[model samples]
Structures are given as structure tokens and as C-alpha cells.
Target: MPPLNDDAIVLRTSDFSETSMVVTFFTRESGKITCLAKGARRLKNPFDTAFDAMNVCRILYYPKSGDVLQLVTEAKLTERFRVDSTVAIYAGFHVVQLLNHFTENFSPQTALFDLTKIILNDILSLNPICRSASLEDPPEKLSRCLLHYELRLLQLVGVAPSLRECVECGEKIEVRRGARRAAFGMREGGVLCPRCRPGKTRVVSLSPEALGALQLLASPEERFWKRLQLSQKTLGEIRGVWNQYLAHQMERPVPIFQWLKR
Candidate 1:
């Protein structure tokens, strides 16, 4: 097989035998791929700094036809995410985990790659800004940004919940008393009108304002960041919705979320 060169972000790596490593990377052209990095664990390994998760690199690999994994020939680091900011570090880990676990292999997910880069850059930049701001503000900002990234990630992976009319019935929903007069159906993948929501439906009550905010968030736009403005309560509601939706779609709990609670 001919060598292929691409830009990639390391997603995860595991020790393989004594000197080799099994690495997973999200590549620009080929999407997610697993590669065997021969002798990458040795002291004089050429891929010494290139195999770390979240490090962007230029990689060369050779694939055997019909094989599940490729052999990495060369990898050179392009960008190494700074580890100085704890918040950025955790956020980077979350992004890598989502890419590694949620996304399918070789699916041509270009948007996911671009969005991940944007979020990581934003997170790194936020560190200095947060340091200059009030003590309580950083966590709030980080949480809001992370929530937005998660929502965007879901949309990119084609699991974005329907936020328009009822997911079951076609009727539009109304909100009352700071709660959706309607209920959200995780199984149905969207809001359900009161009449359509079964007694057994798992619903998260959301306010009219919160519902409106979510609609705006789900809208695909290049300038989404400029348009987003959420109150703390509304942010909390959005977070809850994303949590339930992701849990349902993934069919298992994500460990990184537990880390977020700490």
C-alpha cells in the first residue's frame, strides 16, 4: 500500500507489548482511524511527542487492504495543547473522549474536526480571560461553553434532538409556569405535546425562555457563538437536556461527565 499523509488529532493510545503502541487518531481526510505505532513507546521513539491525546500532528500511514487497523509510518506533532490550564486540560480530555467513543470510524466527519479545534482553541484562550475575571465567573463560563460544545457535537454526529414541534404528534408545544406545558420524550427524540406524552415518558420540564434558548442553540449557523446568551437557570436546563439525550443515544453513561461534576 502507498503511504498516505494527513493531518490528525490523537484521540487515544494504549501500550502494545513492550515497545509498540496502539493509537487512535481523528484524521482530516479519513475520519477516525486506529494505527499501530511500532516501537513508539521506546525512549528514542520518533513519535515520542506525537502520540499524546489532543496533540495535532501530520501523519503518514500505510494500510493493508481490508485490514481494520493501519500501520503508522511517521507522525510529527503540529500542535500540542498546553497543559498549564487545568480547565483546558479537562475540556480537551472531554473532546478527545467524545471523538473517540461517540464518532464512528472512517465516517468523513470534517465538521467534527473543525468544531473540536475551535472549541479547544476557545478553551485555551478562556484561561487567561478567566484569570482576570472574578473568581466565580470561570466555572460558569467553562460550563456554558462546554454545554454549547456538547450540543454542537451531538448535532455533528447526527443525534441532535428535534426541538421544533412534537416529536410524537405534529402539534406545536406551548410553555407555561416556567415549564414546558409539554414534555420532552428522550425515546421520541424531541418535545412531545401534553396529549402525546405517555404516562411513562421520561421528560425534563423546561421554561418557555429555556425552550427558546435551546431552539437558538440548535440552529446551525456560522456565527452561533455571537448569538448565544443564556442565563444560569437556562444553561442548567440545557445541560440537563443534553445529559439525558446523550445518555439515551449512547445507551451508557459517559465517565467524563462524572469528572465534570467534580
Candidate 2:
């Protein structure tokens, strides 16, 4: 059969032999593919720096049957990630790590692939002046970028937390005026209305401010992140709730969250 051609981002790589390497890529046409790039480690190989993590490249590979690895024929670098800011670079890695975790091989995820590219571009465009030394107290722009990417990735993966209605009773939630707190059920899966709040052992209370910020983060509006302003206390609340929710969904702690939160 003819080789399949598509755009892909390098997700991982490991040495296979003295002159070859095994690579995992998230492709635009194919969701995730692990392939052997013969001689990729050589000085003059079919793939050059295209295998570097987070780099985007155009790849040609021959697909295999079940449980068999694909064979990469040719690859050319199309884009390389900027290394100006440590915060931005870590954010990019967070994006790639989630993509690696949420996707399955041989499945097509074109929309997710496009979203990844957009988020990477946004991270790359951050001003050096707006960046910090680490993920702790990240600049507003970088924070927004990461939050948007996390929310969108949840949506794409079909596990987005429900913020509008009670996950238990399916009732629409209405926050009363001067309401200070709301309930979220991590295992039961999202915000819980007052009527459904009783007798739940796993529910956690969230600040109304943090809840509102979450709703905005989940919005489809392209510029919603920019318009939403969150105070430090509220940001911490949101991050805490979000991290717990993620841990519940994945059944384990996300390693990147440590670096991101620190």
C-alpha cells in the first residue's frame, strides 16, 4: 500500500538502535501513531530535528496491522517551538502531555490536532515581559492560555465538567444573589444544585467566584479568557478545584500539575 502523509507533532522519542529511533507522534489525520524511524539518529537521515518533542512536521509513514508499529519513511520539520520563556515551554509540554494521555492510536482527531496547534501558537506569542521564572504566579496571558487549553481539551475528550446544571438531578443551577459558595461533585461529575447537594460524601464546596470563572473558561467564545478577570484568591480556588476534578477523572495525579502549580 501507498504511504500515508499527514502533519504531526512530535510527542515522544526513544533510541531503538545505534542509528534508529522509535517515535510517537500525534498526527492531524491519525490521532496517535508510534513508528520506527530507521536511521533517524544518523547524521544524514530521512528525519532531522523533526523528531524533537513539540516540533511540528510533515510525515510519511506506512501503517501496520493490529499490534504492529508503523514505519516512518520521511519527515520534514515544519515548525519548531520557541525557547524564549521557561513558563511558555512548560505550558507547551503540558499541552502535549495531555494530548498523549487522552488520545488513542489509529483514531482520527482532527479538531483536537488543530486546537493543539492554536494553543502552541498562542503560547509562542506570549510577550517575554509577561513571563515569569516558573509556573508559580504565571503571568495573566500565560495563565489564560493554559486554562483555555485545559478546558478545550476536556471538551474534546468528552469529559468536560458540567458547570451549568446538577450532574445528579439534571436541574438547572441558579446562584442566589450574594451567594458565597457552590457545591461540586467530582465523582458524580460537576456542579450540584442546592436540591441535589444533600447526602453526597464526595462533594466539595467552591467559591462562587471560582465557579463563575470555571463557567467562563468552558465557554466557546474565542476571547472569553481575555475578558475574564480573576483575583489571586479566586485563581487559587479554581486551580484547586480543577486539579481535584482532573485527578478524579484520570484516577491518578497528573505529573505536570505539580510543575504547573509550583
Instruction: For each candidate, give its TM-score against the true structure.
Output: 0.87, 0.93
Worst 10-residue lDDT window, candidate 1 = 129-138
Off by over 4 Å in 2: 175-177
Tens-place lDDT digits, model 1, residues 1-262: 7999999998999988899989999998888889999999899988878888888999999966564779998999888877565556767788888778778777778888887777777777777654544323346557666766777888888787767788777887765455544477788888877777768457776668767767666655636643566766677666766777777888999876764431
Worst 10 residues of 2 by lDDT: 127-136
List where candidate 1 sits over 4 angstroms from the true fold.
129-138, 174-181, 259-262
lDDT of 2 by residue, 146-206 (tens): 7878888889889998887888888876655578578899888888888888988788888
By lDDT, the best candidate is 2
Q: Which pairs of residues clash in candidate 2, taking residues 3 or more apart in a chain or in different chains?
A: none
Task: Give me the overall lDDT of model 2.
Answer: 0.83
Pairs that collide, model 1:
none
Kindly provide the TM-score of model 2 when superposed on the true structure, using C-alpha atoms: 0.93
In model 2, what lDDT does residue 259 have?
A: 53
